[model samples]
Target: MSYIKAGTDVNGNDVKLHYIDQGQGSPIVLIHGWPATYEMWEYQLAELPKHGHRVIAYTRRGFGNSSKTWEGNDYDTLADDLNAVLETLDLQDVTLVGFSMGGGEVARYMSRYNGARVSKVAFVSAVTPFLLKTDDNPDGADKSVFDDMVDGIRKDRFDFLQSFGKKFFGVGVISHPVSQATLDWMQSICQLASPRATEQCVYAFAATDFRQDLATLKVPTLVIHGSSDDTVPAKVSGERMTQYVSHAQFVEYSGAPHGLFVTEKERLNRDILAFAAGGTVEGTADRY
Candidate 1:
């Protein structure tokens, strides 16, 4: 087990990012989502190396070790933070692995800037194109839902994360009957994030529209989603996301939920490695 190394974002804030660097060959950067940290990728860190890939997972600003700033909670700032991390480490030819909200950041950054540094991309249970249901996005969660969520965050960020965490899992119960350990770990990691920062990020995600961003993804892309996901339903966000990305492949896991990257880590890692290895991937794997 490796310890997280400390670092800072482009803004030069005292941001701490936990990372597990393993193996050597191609570099793969794993970006996690809200209410979760780099620790969410523990299973992938341990397994991806055997496939001849260097896997890196880090907590985003306002989550886990990274510094929590009241400012820069929007997607553009988040993308700049990622750029700073990659550039600071002098990493190149990277395969960006983004899960949930992390997917939004990746797509936004790739849309704005594309170079040899980013080779390919992957989205696991992501929120893209757009999350909030506007007049145009009628199928998405209503704006009121996001408003209520933000309201809950303002009322009490901790409890808000706890309740939000429940929605992240398929079985919408607070007790977490399916995977209590994962749930507990998620809560603990979230506790490390700045409550104010998390709350601000909620606004950023709920408002930002990534449809144009997805249209700009020109590199090889992999879109993975859980068929049964309630948070970001496959039929709604993930499916539509694939349609927008020019060179994207879609993979749907039936019966899987939003937390497949956790519950189904092994299978997720397998598919990611195979795709990163330049092989064709089409079909579902085991559900964790």
Candidate 2:
């Protein structure tokens, strides 16, 4: 129930960000994905602490219990908000982990603040490097893909989320990675977010390019993505991250999907714990 003041909104009102700060040794700050609050890290929050690590997860402004401001949805402001949390808490030698859209914040923070207070970073099923396809960025997804997302959200947010949730966890005809109840719960959490922020963030993650930010990473890095991630494909995001961050350990989860955080929670937790402890990460050789 802890909260941090993340600057002020356009109307000069204070914008408070709700965060969960727990556990006691080496800090690990988690930034959640799009349309999700800090609650998404339910398993990690419970597990990481028992292993002697402090886990801090916060709800991005306009999501969950945080302030619902109409602006500051872009990466620059989002990174600043992240900076506020790190500086306010005065955390040091930290492990910053970003999931899905949260990865963009991790990448931007490195470039924006030069990796202050961070020693290690992990990108789990993140949307990083870049996402929109241009003539030069051929591997990027088509602009139309993002366009449709915006249109869908604007048209019918709940309906779009319901459909998107299925694809997020790789829920197919025969393959049910997550139960229907889990999907329903996720949708309920997503529905708590401000509709304006939800729609605006779609453009932020889709259009913002993090290639330069990725190059600025100097700390130990880990890139983990699913091989069958249809949301943010491995080829365009995680696979390409290794090119910029030459020393990063890349691990591809075979047959996993975008929501690997939930679908592969145990494996994901183990890998993150190993990396945080400066130990050898499992499946580093299984790069796809």
Candidate 3:
């Protein structure tokens, strides 16, 4: 891994983004979910490269070692920050992967920058299309959920994460319970983020609509979600998002929780590798 650093312009206002570059060949950029730093994708960072793909995973603006400012935590700026990293590195034929909140960055990237120089896109248990329920979006998540999230954090961040972390991995799910170690590690990462970023992003992810972006994405896409995902249920997010994509391959892990990356790491990695390699899947987009 190269030395960790942030990019800055003439004014030094700070385009603070930190990422790890590894391996050789086609690039795969992994954007982490909410309340998680680059460390969350440790498995992908370590395993994907062994298959000969250059992997890049980064902490979003306020997570990990990146600068944490009071404002500009919105999705548009987040997407711009991601694009800056890609453009600075002059990456091409890249496979952009977004998980959970990070998925917003992917959608915004394609919508805002027209996915400049991107090859493929993927979402893992992401929040997209539209998360918060509204007049037209009847199946969406409730605004109260997001409000409660901000409430929880403002009330007591560390305690809130301890419980939020449990819901994230579906601790009591009988089929596949996430290990306690993973849950604790997840909380650690979540707590590492700027509390302000964590609080503000709740409003961003819940309110932002990506239906337009998803419809216009002119790249092969992968939509992976867990059937039992409690946070961003597949029915509202991944399942519904397929309708917007022109050419998409949807994979729903049966009874899998939202954090399938940890619960079902190996299978998820293979699916991602296959998607990046242009491998075929039996099911079609319309099937979802």
Clashes of each: 1, 0, 0
Per-residue lDDT over 71-90 for candidate 1, one digit per residue giving the tens place of the 0 to 100 score? 76788878877787677677
Model 1 alpha-carbon drift over 4 Å, by segment: 1-16, 172-177, 284-288
Which of the two, 2 or 3, has more TM-score? 2
**Model 2 over residues 1-288: C-alpha lDDT tens digits?**
689999999999999999999999999999999999999999899899999998999999989999999999999999999999999999999999999999999999999999999999999999998998988788888888888998999999999999999999999999999999999989998999999899899989999989899999999999999999999999999888888888888999999999998999999999999999999998895232
Reference-based lDDT, each prediction: 0.78, 0.93, 0.85
* Superposed model 2: Cα runs more than 4 Å off: 286-288
Scored against the true structure, residue 240 in model 1 reaches a CA lDDT of: 81
Which residue pairs in model 3 clash with each other?
none
TM-score of 1: 0.89
**Quick one: best TM-score, which candidate?**
2
Query: Which of candidates 1 and 2 reaches a greater TM-score?
Result: 2
User: RMSD to the native, candidate 2?
Assistant: 1.3
lDDT of 3 by residue, 165-199 (tens): 88788876554387778888888878878989999
